[model samples]
Target: MSLDYDLVIIGNSLEASYAAVKAAKLRARVALVLGETETNTYTEIDRSTFNCLTYLDKKGQNLTQWELNYDFVTHLNSSQIQTWITQVKQDIKEYYSPAILADLGIDIIGESGEFCRLPALGFVIKNRTLRSRNYLLAMGSISSIPKIEGLSELGYLTLETLDLENLPYDLIILSQTPIGIELAQSLNHLGKKVTLVVEDSNILPQEDAEAVQLIQAQLEAEGIKLLVNCPITQVRKIEDKKWIQAGNEALETDEIILITKPTPNIKGLNLEGVKVEVQPQQIIVNDKLQTTNPKIYACGSIIGGYSLSNLAKYEANIVIKNAIFYSIFQVNYHPLPFHIFTHPILSRVGLTETQARQSYGDDIIIIKQNYKTLAKAQILDETTGFCKIITRRNGIILGGHIIGNNSDELINFIALSIKNNIKIQQFSQLFPSYYTISEILFQISENWQYQKLQENKFLNNWLETLLFWRRRWKL
Candidate 1:
């Protein structure tokens, strides 16, 4: 077509960067319009350096990649869970440099540019009259402000605002998502009176129900008031008081914060010439990340489905393969692992119990194990959670959910197992040691048999008591 440029990447986010790098490799003349600096911008770090742990392996030697991967999968699984982590780390190390684009003759534009549609070209934008051949829109989502009546009048802060670090507020009301919960908990831990409002019945509702219960208990224990099933009806300001009404009851909070929703940034793009469609807050794309305009593609939070940074990066790679290499590979969303980084984090992949039941009927079996009985969780002194495995009647592991200290890292094991069709019997056969949380999988896998043996209650109690005594005596 011989257009102005090969590809124009609209955002400098993780997904956008990935797409840009892939496009560059295809020898596409690329341009990046970045709103912020690229170095370490999206990475999360622990600010409490004093509490961070530096561990030494049993050999008292440095750990190798194989060691880390072996230990990780030994505790978890070897499927996409490991692949996703490895790819992200590899991508960051190999292609994360901002200067790489410039070195490849890709132009970097600092200011924000809006998209426009012209008669000849299906989609286009003007960077002071310089148009591009293909447009890759990745502006990301904007924070959603609840229609609180007085919120705007009293002033508020969002993730974007809080990211600035200058717009100070005394108190912040947050939602239950990672951004909301993490910020609220962090500020509260730093002496801010933050109240987390969850319209859903529980925090991290998408997580395992048991995980959600454990996290809710932990958050409540931390003195964070969790208002469940109470939607913020109105936010109004009276004099200096910021009043928030949930249903009929009114409460006053100092500041209001809205978490971002999955909304496409195509408002002024003028897509009249293109056949792409957007509903409510997102763009419609097929499994291949292809838009209605066959020649165009989309990825990241703009698509409204799975919006994790890792998922977006995967989608970006898919787009690159399809667009540049003309490969027929499609995006597979099965066994997508996501983590909620609350205090006792929650992580899940595949179907929940509710989902499995609806999809596979009541013949589904759920295996569960407690963390208190696990040696590692007990040793870590964080035994408030458990792992639940959902399987079909024939013993296919459908999903895995974990809610506890290392659930974020551990859920991948279940994800890998499910993705690879690893059966419950195989998992049980591994026979992980007693003290590790991974043992929970083995414990649950054998739970059906244990339940049958529980017919003799007294004998079971006697056996449990004997085991407890033996462990206690050993200690």
Candidate 2:
């Protein structure tokens, strides 16, 4: 069987679905071949695990209702989030309507798509026979498995299957990530022995260090054994006893969980015939999300870019504008905000101190403020993290990183600041009052710019003299 359309989206994700919907709206005939049942499969997982009711903090104090509510409420008020919610809703209403998609000649082939070959033109997707087209591969990714001996025989769960219900087990060994950490914490709170092994220096390595530390402390307080810098080498189950080997040591556990990396789900699609290149584990795509062949494009996790759902959606928008409308839209990932859904949540945008230092130099200034100093954080009893801002010599906001309650929501303001190249003084002037964690940026700006100048003796002396003269003149 053969069908023709202006565009054929090869995955049913937030990215692919939105792209299909937008293209159809632009009066282009589109089709979507989906491997999954729905657009937001990961979102259907039990997010209640991240709720404060699941675990306790370092002080052995249970998370208050206010703290959870505050985080939830603040997330609703985020500027970046409002846009996402609106876009997603619009896309769903348009594409999900059978009449609209049918009217636009948009066909959704709900099947587990397989790649047949990589030809000189594009990949051939085979359900049974060879299906070729000007394809947009958005097949997404799967969790990476560690090369551990006997792991296959012992049985393990990836992030995709970790939330299976009513599975009784005495102990669970988790490789740390957002999903792994939340699972470990939730299981531990539910009265299970959970050991979390992190290959990185911290649990959420992508998050702010202070935030990682706070989350680590909280997990440890809840009796979650956190092993850092240790790579699991082997897993074997002998006579119902599971032995996990990690760095010259063996720990016995009932279950093992992998959260290391996510492999792109593009193996079955036979790409060799189409000659579309697949390097290592990712598909090559240009700024416009086009593959080597101009007619073919790719997006989402398959492109090996930022794996956040929101980022994928953003890329989808760009693809629709460029591919269908022929608009001069290019993908710009700068100031891309990310959030780690831990208890207090860790969020960041633009650059980190390490990244900024690499781009700039030692002359860069870092301003750090603790969440304890924030009135709302203290009142909510979740003041365990801090916010750090990286700026240049001229007080240009280089990046913003926050590890505290509502950090995910708070990072949006910083994302906007970095996007607009808003200066430190401008940020301070706009947000002068301390109403919430969002105002913490302004508070940091007030001290950060002047402190750098004060550290320079010559500049400090000149400023002091100028201040004295102004006082004498009463100006």
Candidate 3:
């Protein structure tokens, strides 16, 4: 069958860009339909830098009596941060422009695309109908706005509308999304009264309790109030204040933000008409990242989760491999860390403490490393969080969860250890670096081995006997 292109990508998101570049490099004819999807890749960085500013501000308050550079952090504001974000966004857009993709031999379609038929499939973009053997649905997701009373007429804000001036002085954030918590902290740091409404007991229910609790303490210390186990039932405008009936209280705030889950943007693709299986929230795909329609595939937010660029890039590669090479490769993300960019940052990989306990029961051993013990954290006045590592009784690592500055970087080493099945005793005890967070892992690894050896009666007796024998022989 003579097809128009080898593949037709249906969005201009990070996943779409990744597919376009890889397909182009593979010498396969590819068409990227930008369509009506407007993308903003700087959202993560924008969220992260605000926390960075907050950290800097805290540091300035603690150490400005002596350090000159630390005193300057007080002058930072939202306007300056926005300008930096705009400049970076411009640089990134130019680097990944449609013209650049075209130079790399990819057909860039400015118009929207719709599926024409199934089994023998093709995408119709305006006057052109590009036929392809396979399709990659990287269109991402639309914000799944909830059906709250007076929410539509009264109006509300979201993670998207952060640039507007005259934003609410007192903001009420609905949930604990990565963006929601980050926005809460940033807005609070920017002089707004931010209240995070968590329906559960913990702020970040997906993470380990210890880590989540530490981050919660940090948030509270920074003046961002957390309203846990408080679910909002109704939202309405009372004169000038936005009021919400949450739990037993009728809380009033200047603005209300619903951090609702995002649903896949598969409505226009007409998947049901073509018999492509889709669940309530996302398109149904197998471990190989293939949809019910073998000729089609989906990734990123279209699969229904947080819209993270790294996850998008990872899933896109999985799609490309299974779709192009005809290989069955299940998506393996065990080693990839799930990070939340809160004030001190939180990162986790593999099984959490609870999950490890459930899986290994009494065989699990938890080793905790405090940031207060690290010279780097003490030097930077970031001695507020800790790293909790879970492992088998005999020292095989099961998980790593950290909450602190540079924790995002420190968790990667433990993730690698878990991925490669490295034992705590097997890891070398030589950490020559001083005043660095990396030493925490080395210190904890040594402690795990020494404690296990010392606690075991048989091992300790055997070592003692060996030492006595060696002394007697004098060899």
TM-score winner: 3
Model 2 spans with C-alpha error above 4 angstroms: 1-3, 35-105, 111-133, 174-178, 200-211, 325-329, 432-434, 456-475
Ranking by lDDT: 3, 2, 1
Global lDDT of each model?
0.65, 0.68, 0.78
All candidates: CA RMSD (Å):
10.4, 6.3, 2.5
Per-model TM-score versus the true fold: 0.75, 0.80, 0.92
Better of 1 and 3 by TM-score: 3
Q: Which lDDT tens digits does candidate 3 get at residues 1-475?
A: 5888778888867679888898889888888988775754335556666667665655565566566755245655667767766776667768679889999999888887678774567787777778986899987665667776778888887666655355758888987456678778877767788888877766777788888777788789888878889866788887888898888988889888777666676667777765689876688887878888878888887786666777788898888777777858789877777678887888888888888888888998888889899999988777888888888997888888898879888777777788888887665566648988888888788878777877899989998999999999994
Please list the residue runs of candidate 1 whose C-alpha ends up more than 4 Å from where it truly belongs after superposition. Answer: 3-7, 26-95, 104-119, 122-134, 163-178, 260-262, 431-435, 448-475
Per-residue alpha-carbon lDDT of model 1 for 1-475, expressed as tens digits? 4566666777756678778877887888777777443322223322111011111121112234335434532221223223444356556646656677678777777665454454344333353634555566676766556666556777877654554233234554657355566656555544446677777676666656667677777767777776777787777877776777765567776667776454565655555446678775688888777777756678887888535777788788888777665648798876778765556566778888888888989778787887888878766667888788888866788888787767777788878887788877777688886666778777887884565456569989999999999999994
Point out the higher-scoring one by lDDT: 2 or 3.
Answer: 3
lDDT of 2: 0.68
Model 1 weakest lDDT span, ten residues long:
50-59
